[model samples]
Target: MPAESNMSTHSDPQSSETAFLEMRDVVAGYGNTTVLHDINIGVENGQIACLIGPNGSGKSTLMKSIYGFADVKSGTITVNENDITGRSPQENLMAGMSYVLQDASVFPQMTVHENMLMGGYVFDDDSQAARRAEELYDEFPILGDIRNQNAGTLSGGQRRLLELARALMVDPEIMMLDEPSIGLEPRFIEDVFDRIKQLNNLGTTILLVEQNAQKGLSVADRGFVLASGEIKFTGTGTELLNNDEIGRLYLGG
Candidate 1:
């Protein structure tokens, strides 16, 4: 079971409300390569926060740092009020955070059902994990339909769906998605975003890095613009979408 986190009292007074997840002056990198420079971002409880920027802007790196895959040289990362900086990935997961990376992270040789079982690896009880998998299958019926097929044999979109279904096994409070719409067809991309919205409606707070700025912002409550490892803009999704500078710079105006 994951720890029940407490909400932080310290917050930016200018903001309308306190955040559920916050990164304060975060300076993180991999090895000697500094990717995120003094990054500060936050996501409120049950809201979908989207990260958008040009390639190499460190959007993914910021998400990686939150997932504990990158090294934090300074600053702090807090979930609720817990300082989770420098924690291991497993530690973060146990603290009620779930991360889905940009790549196809499924076990290619395993059946879809088996791959989903891997998601609950953190839980000691096998029966509980199995129950969770069944619950996700009900939520994502396509996954249930092809549960016996080998993961590698599925289509690109199906694979992505499996990856998402697997991540839901833990019923995480905060779900960090890295480019969830990356390689799907137009219809499948719509489906993916729809799933994201549905998850948000079900009370999961989301933080995601997306290449499709227009669609990403459309589904998000808040949007962030990162450039060269720094935050350039922060506002409601509609505000950024309507900003001429943001549209010209990132939204393919």
Candidate 2:
């Protein structure tokens, strides 16, 4: 692994104690296959942290491991100082974490409003889900305008927005997004990123895995570089963006 850049902005040795989400010495992967080794990362509360790397660097695996989709061979994962290792996806959702996958995940046959309500299925009262959907629609008026339309009929950008809105129905404390900008036109990418910032500003911490390195780091409060299943660099967004080595090796400078 490359040496971490020396220009990090937050250098406190006790940062882990303050981190809202943390992974310590995690070794994880699919069954019978270990893809991550000794992974340690932390995302501060209410901050946007971006993970970037070349293809096949185990970015998606890390996210899956955190959300309990992948097996963790060893180590601990935590949120708000609560150990959450090996928690189920449903449990994680109930614990205030939401994950938006890299693939298109909308229920094609369902109407936009119905899909949004699905996100709040954990709610015991159906009326609560309905009210939450209305709150989301207010935040995303574009989704509200097409509330009755089938989700499959929406454009790429609109679909992405709906996915985001759906995830917000539960008002999660932290959201994990995998390649949120994928499969969209250049015009929609910026819009999606802007919404991400908006969500962060609204007090949701974010862990983002983005293929677009430069753009991802540009918006991140903190950045991590994962390569060959290990972390190679850790720094503030600006620190990584300006480092000559990172610029050459990862940012296509």
RMSD of each candidate relative to the true structure: 6.5, 2.6
Off by over 4 Å in 1: 1-17
Q: Compare the candidates by lDDT and give the number of the best one.
A: 2
Residues 97-162 of candidate 1: C-alpha lDDT, one tens digit per residue: 889889989999999999999999899898888899999888999999999999999987888888
TM-score of each: 0.93, 0.95
In model 1, where is the ten-residue run with the lowest total lDDT?
1-10
True-structure RMSD for candidate 1: 6.5
Query: Candidate 2, after superposition: displacement of residue 226 in Å?
Result: 0.3
Q: Alpha-carbon error at 79 in model 2, in Å?
A: 0.3
* Per-residue accuracy of model 2 over 1-253 as CA lDDT, tens digit each: 2334354322322248888889988999998999999888888999999999999999999999999999999999999999999999999999889999999999999999989989999999989999999988888888999999999999999999999889998899999999999999999999999999999988899999999988899999989889889988788888788778888888898
